[model samples]
Target: MQPGTFELLILIFIFLGLQAWWIIPIINKNNKFNKRGKDLREEIKQLEKLYKK
Candidate 1:
């Protein structure tokens, strides 16, 4: 309610928003990468006999 306090709060939100702009994508990409790796491992497990041949 004080003068300039709202501006500071807005700036903090902007900074957090910018940080999330990259952080969220980075986390999502990391999750996707991990999921893909897990899927590949599962596929390899299912085909392990083929690799031995």
Candidate 2:
């Protein structure tokens, strides 16, 4: 209800929004790499299974 507190809340939201804008793309890129890593691990496991058999 206080004007100063409201302004502070708005500033915090703006800061967090900006941070998310910058961070989300990096997180998405990392996710892509993580998915690729998982796929590679699966392939490796399959290869090992084939070799054992």
lDDT, candidates in the order shown:
0.96, 0.98
Off by over 4 Å in 2: 51-53
lDDT of 1 by residue, 1-53 (tens): 88999999999999999999999999999999999999999998879978888
Off by over 4 Å in 1: 49-53
TM-score of 1: 0.81
lDDT at residue 29 of model 1 (Cα atoms): 96
Distance from true position, residue 41, model 1, in Å? 0.6
Candidate 2 displacement at residue 31 in angstroms: 1.3
TM per candidate comes to: 0.81, 0.71
Please list all clashing residue pairs in model 1, or write none if there are none.
none
True-vs-predicted CA distance for residue 20, candidate 1, Å:
0.5
lDDT of residue 48 for candidate 1: 93
1-53: candidate 2 lDDT, tens digit per residue: 76699889989999999999999999999999999999999999999999999
